[model samples]
Target: MTITDAPPGTRPARRRTIGTVLLWLLLLPGLCWTVIRLGGWEGHSPLVPLLAFTPYVAVGAWVPALIGLLTRRRLPGVVALLTAVALAACVLPRALPDLDKGLSRGVALHVMTSNMLFGGADAATIVTLVRENDVAVLAVQEFSPGAERSLAEAGLGDLLPYSQLSPEWGATGSGLYSRYPLTGTGTRINQGGFHQAYGVIQPDGAAPVLVESAHPLAPAGLDLLAGWAGDMAAEPRADPAGTARILLGDFNSTLDLAPLRTLIASGYRDAADTVGRGLVGTWGPYDGDPIPPVTIDHVLADTRIGVQDVTVHNVPRSDHRAVIAGLILPMAS
Candidate 1:
């Protein structure tokens, strides 16, 4: 018989080889993703925006493992299992709460952050959340003059009277409102023209804390990625010896990105991650898109500050959720 008319036994061997080739093809992407993430090679243009989906990729990594095992390919199965475990190791910690002692002994300060989607978030709902949660400070991004008026009309002024507002006509606006008096208030406009409002608030029985409403430009395209990185890098680093600080709002980045992680490594801890709420998504689908949700908004507090709790809330007419953090500030010595 010719090669085209091979026997049935020979055909089985050919099928096995093809299956092995297919398994490798399926395994390549997951393997590359794990390596890039672990190696910190995701600092490039497209990878920066793409790595935001690592958590989902980590979940999908299991498919290769199962396929490898089902096909009885020992080497591929071993590699696939190891890749899944490695990816999980990188992702699973965000869900586990850290053992943070002495957090309950300090002065309590509750703060909330929200993005108004260019001034369209429900003002009343935001006010209700602030009132119900007893939020001491509120950081708003994409804040506009119309939003400022709507929030004031909704009685937000009655709740958080002290304010350092930079309400522009469009997406560049931002504001920081607090129940406590604000001092040294100003707005920092980043490279992409995104405004970040900041101030110092001294609560009763606590030392002064600097708070900033962070709204770095989104890396929507390759051209914006550098500006996004620059904005994140420009975020103030926490000094354990200096004034304690808190940054809350739409960071437009996830922890998976190297830039955000680098910023967090500078003496600040993610409040949600500290309390096991880090994996919870704060952005996506609120505007009725079919995209998967990701945790882009955050409450990053100084390492000296203690995180008590964190919760996310929904606001109408906005694509982002509001993140509230219960924090403990250091007492005045």
Candidate 2:
């Protein structure tokens, strides 16, 4: 054989070695993601934004496992298989409905939340969603003065009469409108200057419920990551021994993030997750960008609240899809 020519069996052996290397390269990222996710390292700068796409990564993880197995690399195949399983374990549960057998019977309340995209979403569509869904409460993010006027002109006042609004010029504003009278209305501004409007409402036969429109800053870049984490940390927790609470809007956080998970662990259930609709994407592509959809907007209710159903809907000119949650609130004690 010439210098450049391979010996009889060397070609096959070299090919195997290169294939093994490629297989390991393919397997390593998913393995690292699993480790970081399990270890709660997603709070770090790059990992913060990276973890938001964990669902997609989990779905793609099987490719490496399949490749390794078909290539007859037993160790790499087994490792890749285990890595896929671990990632899947972290993600698949969001698609399965939770067994909420302990939920108490009470008043039925329909709540809808949407991001107005800097007052750009079609107000008529939002009002129609509120009217047709029989929405008892509506929480809006990126609420602006123009949006409020548009919604008012769209006849939102006739249906939901009560309002607590923090209208601004940009994405910093938020508001809460309810069919029932709202008391203790106020706004909490996070470190990122996003407005979170809140109020207490008492439905006909149920206990008082504190509802808040949450709009944490998006972790789009390294500069905003700290603020995003801070805002998420500042979210009001559900008090089991106190008022039943609901927090909903553009959280700018996915269920895979540590901060959002911690918030949910603090006496709240993600409404969509409870009803097996959590995997549905609530943001992306609506603004005409070529981005994959992700579940960032959420309706988080106290554990005592029973989530009967949850759905996502489209709104023209908005980047986010509206999330509507049907909740059963416990009766007054």
Candidate 3:
């Protein structure tokens, strides 16, 4: 054979090598995560709750993958990039904000919600967020007795003139404070058997809006997961006739949960999703993590409520960040 003669099995061997590389690229964790996320797998298992953040995990997988691909720049590398792009295309619509829906015309209100982290959140930090945002109403979960005392000592009574509080021993406690009078004050115990504080707030010259500080149980196990799902399902089927309903606090869930998704599908929209702030993490900087990872806290409003803006703020001495929303609710003439 000449010096340049092809090896006996070179062509088939090369084809097999390329095919194997492509298959491996397609089998990466990123691709698996994307498929699972797109499949909508929310169940009672602990992994299901963890799956709520799969989009972030999928997006994160790209860093090392792209670095390796760029360094290699072979067929496998190209396939990997295509895989990532395909995943992004498949999942982005949910993560991206739907701005096509215009704001509903009405009276505007600023609202904030926080989880006080077992009474550990500093009162001044919480109050500063309230004042800086000019928050008209504030809702909190895990509002323990000590937290209530600290809030009073820090001048929250003067800052927010009206209040409805249900302080339990652990994470069950919840509270709502409003600049406007909170009428029809009631405590709603959700399916998880935790008390949720709710009321109607009347803004001058506007129809009263129903507000609920919603804190479903954290799904740390199967029972809690079931409870969380049940708590979400038990919420009154949203009244979409523009009476204006707002539920804000630590849901212990993300939009990925089937129950939360169903809640939105029924009639409400998350303020952050409405405003185009995609997947801003409101949950953990936990276990030496640098930044918040998943968004479990939320401010959800009825479709009729116009969301002008939504933001999350860092609260000192707490694991959860606070969510603030600027909402315009329909006013009853």
Candidate 4:
């Protein structure tokens, strides 16, 4: 039943034409996209392809996968399979953003992001990890009133000493705690009913760093993702110091998403990538299955901030693990 063993009849001209069209249609966009991605030279584009066209990127995986499916041609199928594998390696990592093992050692600065589940099941355990690490800064999401009190009692206030706490309408609230002196805090950054806090963190004798602790309204619909991108766009412009920003939170969007692209184009570098760390899945003990753990927590910073190490701390109390990162600020020459 192989093509070579077919009966002594020529294939139809129409069949040949359709195959040609399908081949061209499948190959062209993927090839062009690969080229475009390579050409970017790790530079910024006004609109990042991932965030702007998430659907295109997601479904685009089929180009190579389909090539693998349809082709009987040995060379073509192998090429398609290899291409698909490589792209998947590059792109699929984003699906587990927490898997990124971030910086270590060369850290002049560090931040830890965790979702406390707002005083859910294990508030005490979460607080202990925070205290034990001596986390210089902590960004917590889903803080409940009782959890807040427990965190305070766990010596978070004495350790960080300077902090901002806000209880918004949703179950998720954002807070920032710093060992350094806090210069100021800004108005809320709201998008589609989601509220985030923006503020400044300045250590003694060091230049101030703008920190935005946000849990952007996750996209429940097609328009919501784009709207999230638009909201992030305002951060840099609204807080000019956002270029010197450190964003830590559970974005709920994967690194492969367009929102991340938009953030990177605005001059942020993923700390995990910079540090060359392994995948650190922050969320999901999912029914105790470890094969594919989920990671929603992230630590992103400006390129000027060098990452030395990033680690995922497991807190048995909450559903999400904590993303802890160490950063090195540019040395003054």
Writing each residue's lDDT as its tens digit, candidate 3 over 1-333 gives 532375866766665666556656654766666556566665676766777676566577566457546556466566567657766664466556686544567788999998998887889989888888999999999989999999888888887989999988778888999999999998888877677898899887677888999888888787677787788878755686646788998888776667777787777888887776647888878424685488888888888778888888888888888999998877776
RMSD of each: 1.5, 1.4, 4.3, 6.7
Model 3 alpha-carbon drift over 4 Å, by segment:
1-22, 25-28, 60-86, 89-97, 101-104, 286-292
Index of the highest-lDDT prediction: 2
Model 1 alpha-carbon drift over 4 Å, by segment: 1-4
lDDT, residue 318, model 4: 70
Clashing pairs in 2: none
Which stretches of candidate 4 lie above 4 Å from their native place? 1-72, 75-79, 92-107, 118-121, 221-227, 235-243, 284-292, 331-333
Looking at model 2, which ten-residue stretch has the lowest summed lDDT?
A: 1-10
Q: Tell me the lDDT of candidate 3.
A: 0.78
lDDT of 2 by residue, 164-266 (tens): 9999999999999999999999999999999999999999989899999999999989999999988999999878888889999999998889999999999
Candidates 3 and 4 compared by TM-score, better number: 3
Worst 10 residues of 1 by lDDT: 97-106
Model 4, TM vs. native? 0.69
> For model 1, how does the per-residue alpha-carbon lDDT over 1-333 read when each residue is reduced to its tens digit?
653588878988887888889988898899999998888787646888788889999999999899999989999888988999999998898899889722577899999999999998999999999999999899999999999999999999999999999998878999999999999999999998999999999998998999999999899899988889889889888887889899999998988887888888988989998898889988888889887899999999998888989999999999999999999998988
| CA lDDT scores, all candidates in order | 0.91, 0.92, 0.78, 0.61
Local error of candidate 2 at residue 139 (angstroms): 0.2
Please give each candidate's TM-score.
Answer: 0.97, 0.97, 0.85, 0.69
Higher-scoring candidate on lDDT, 2 or 3: 2
| Residues 109-212 of candidate 4: C-alpha lDDT, one tens digit per residue | 77888776654536566556667766778887776677677777766777788877775434557677788776677546566544455578765544567776
